[model samples]
Target: MYIPELYKNENAEEIKSFIKTNSFGILVNQTQGKLWGTHIPLELETNLQGKEVLFGHISKENPQGESFTDNNEVLSIFNGPHSYISSSWYDHENVPTWNYIAVHVYGKIRIIEGEELLFAMKKLVDKYEATSKNPVKIENLSAETMRQINGITAFEIEITDIQAVHKLSQNRDDKNHNTIISELEERKDNNSQAIADAMKKQRS
Candidate 1:
């Protein structure tokens, strides 16, 4: 991730919360000497043995599924809010940059099937469906609809390492930092406002 010391975030709880909030991530792996990546929703969880892991699935037709062999390692990237930071907002002359948060997780793939796969799918569905006005339950699906699970490859990744970066103008002085937050908040876009909020939270 090439994170500088100034921008690195080492707080475990914070990083976990970030991942849960931004669970849709990019899963990267190599198959047949070619690197493949898939954008999917991953759930951070603890396995029966108390080891941290990520659970997700992809269609069986996806070529990336070929990479899910024994001992195969993979990389999952989770991105958070980001916004441009104009140098004009700083008290002194400086180059413009971007403020953002991201996480990189590396792990070994473990293909799951039978009840394990069904359980994983249930959890994934329940999590996202919570926000719906009329939330749908996986158990309520018809047999024909449930048959679609046969076409997917569900797997878990035993986490080996996690790297988190939070570049929110931490290098700036208090005056400049406050100014940057103000400028970001003035912008109407969601990313800008999110950066502003994150900066405030960091200071808090």
Candidate 2:
């Protein structure tokens, strides 16, 4: 995450909120001298010891899971909305660029099993199901369904560092910034609209 000073977001609360909203992230680690990445939903949490950590799991069959040994460090990347900005949006001639938000978390990975795995899984399920019309609880699952856990490996990553980037054209002047937002909103796509909204919020 090479964030320029102008784009770097140092606000802890905003970064935490971004991670929670964009919990589905890419977990990267080295396996057999080669890098492997897994896409998964990671829950940001505070362990009993009061240390910040991430909880997630992957299928036992996933080769990436092997990298969790020896408390190896890992990188988790969370991405938010992004869109291309046309140079024409700016009043003065300038090169086109992009606007987006992203976060990178570095941590030490440790495999978790037994009750800890089950508890982590329960929390993950409960969080996602909260918005469902007919919510399902992990405890309500049948023994056979619960047996599926045997095929997966759960782990926790104790966070050591977090880097957040919010590249929302902060370098531009007020007129150009507002124009960029207007153009993005007119694009009518989710990413464009999201970037526009974020720009508006940043200004407010």
Task: Give one digit per residue, the lDDT tens place, for model 2 in 61-150.
Answer: 998887778438999999999999999888888898989999999989999988778878888999999999999999999999999999
Worst 10 residues of 2 by lDDT: 44-53
TM-score winner: 2
User: What TM-score goes with each of the models?
Assistant: 0.96, 0.96
Candidate 2 clashing pairs, residues 3+ apart or interchain:
none
Q: Write the per-residue lDDT of candidate 1 for residues 78-170, one digit (tens) a residue.
A: 999999999988778889999999999999999899877877888888999999999999989999999999999999998999999999999
Q: Which RMSD values do the candidates have, in order?
A: 1.3, 1.1
Give the C-alpha lDDT of model 2. Answer: 0.91
Kindly report which residue stretches of model 1 are placed more than 4 angstroms away from their true locations once superposed: 48-50
Q: How many backbone clashes does candidate 2 have?
A: 0
Off by over 4 Å in 2: none
